[model samples]
Target: MNAPARLRVAAGQATSVPRDVAANVATACSLVTTAADQGARVVVLPELFLTGYAAEEWRHDDSLALDASTGSGGPDERLRPLADLARERGVTVVASAAVRRALDASTLSAVVLTPDGEVRAPYDKQHLCGLEEQGFFTAGDHGATIVVDGWELGLGICYDGSFPEHAASAAAAGATAYLTPAAFFTGSDHRRDLYYAARAIDNGIYVVFAGLTGTCGASSFSGGSAVYDPEGRAVARTGADDPAVVVADLDIAEVRRVQDEVNTVARDRRDSLGHRERLEVGRAG
Candidate 1:
């Protein structure tokens, strides 16, 4: 029997010390160490992880934003340490930070630090939540996808995963795995949990969610970090429980099994429904 493209992924769910990018990056580095120790090739973190998802505090701190130029950090340098850590640990790190698009524009973006320590193109969140105001952030025009070990991993931030159409666009473009880095709040758990799995089954792709867990004073997030299979099954999950690292081995060929049996994306559509008409269907990751 032929084996699938088995990628070991880790969703590192942990709390952050509000407004401290350096400290949060430290926490993420530690978690990445743990996940890497468990043999995870890819580690995806929560949304706005470097800033701890401090929301208004993050929005107000102009100094906290990352620039489009270099992947350095802090007044001295903080983010590069995480990339260095990823290189040392031999893991691909997907972590979010606020990006300064222009002098007047900024957006929440996921930066991939490869195992070789190269900074891939940043995946900016296209669908902004209420907090991402007009002047603060420039909404991204296109979705982002990265090819790793031959797997096309689609990128999405917290609120972006909630919409069916957003994920649909990525799937349309041949994304084998939708990796959502998010900070979902308390009441949003049930809906997000249900929707993440549905996105996997409905699209016949792997869905991996790495979300912020725990509370910061009055604010809190749904701590459920999870990974779902193409069959819409929970390969790994951590509910609103604790800061933990959940890892799963995704069988990429299942995309073919599910599609060959059901064939939703290829057979069920009418006119792409306002979406562009380029079919980039994946060959099982």
Candidate 2:
């Protein structure tokens, strides 16, 4: 018989520090260590966690602008310690940081760090909101995925979660779980919860959304870190504006069962017809 595929994951709702890389890294390290101690094999953090989600701040500061890591440029020096912690604790961590893509000097990206301290797949935000466009960060070309503990995981940032294509492409790529690290602001909780649940139901996969809480600069984050099961059920969740680590144990077999039962319907399609049409148009372009 195949080994039972069960894993315990943690969603870290942290307080981000705008323009403070060292302090943010320190907080992330501490959170990872704490999550590992709690037997969390996989820990997910919020988007642009290291430098907070203050896109406006990056626009004015030269230091902050120069500090972004190009997704392919490997890990940042400040984040090396967290990588070391992951190696030491044997926990697979998914954290986000403001990254600069070397290929296009005009773009800043979000990256995922693997357990072995290596830069895993990078999912640039395809949807930029408000001041993000003014910050000069270009969108990513395509979505990406990572495999951990017999599970295919998809990566997306805050705004990326707003788009169905991001999660749909990952599911089509055989991802059983969708992981999003976000810094969603106030009044956005309802939308976040709705999207997460909708994504799970539509794709027949688990959705884990880790968000930042508390205030950073002029923005206040709505901390509703959540984990949705394959059937669009929120198996684990935290209250609004709470800073805590939410843990959930997922059974991969249930995901398979749900897909077989609910995903066979035409309405539960893996590829939306609209998305397919767009892909065809882009290819022909």
User: Which candidate ranks first by lDDT, i.e. highest?
Assistant: 1
TM-score of each: 0.86, 0.85
The residue-by-residue lDDT of candidate 1 on 133-221, one tens digit each, is 44466787778887767788899987788788887788889888899998888898888788888888778889889988887535898
Q: After best superposition, candidate 1 residue 236: deviation in angstroms?
A: 0.5
Backbone clashes in model 2, listed as residue pairs: 69-100, 70-100
Where is model 2 more than 4 Å wrong at Cα? 1-4, 59-74, 102-108, 263-285
Q: Please list the C-alpha lDDT of all candidates, in the order they appear.
A: 0.78, 0.74
Q: Which stretches of candidate 1 lie over 4 Å from their true place?
A: 1-4, 60-65, 69-76, 131-135, 263-266, 272-285
lDDT of 1 at 228: 91
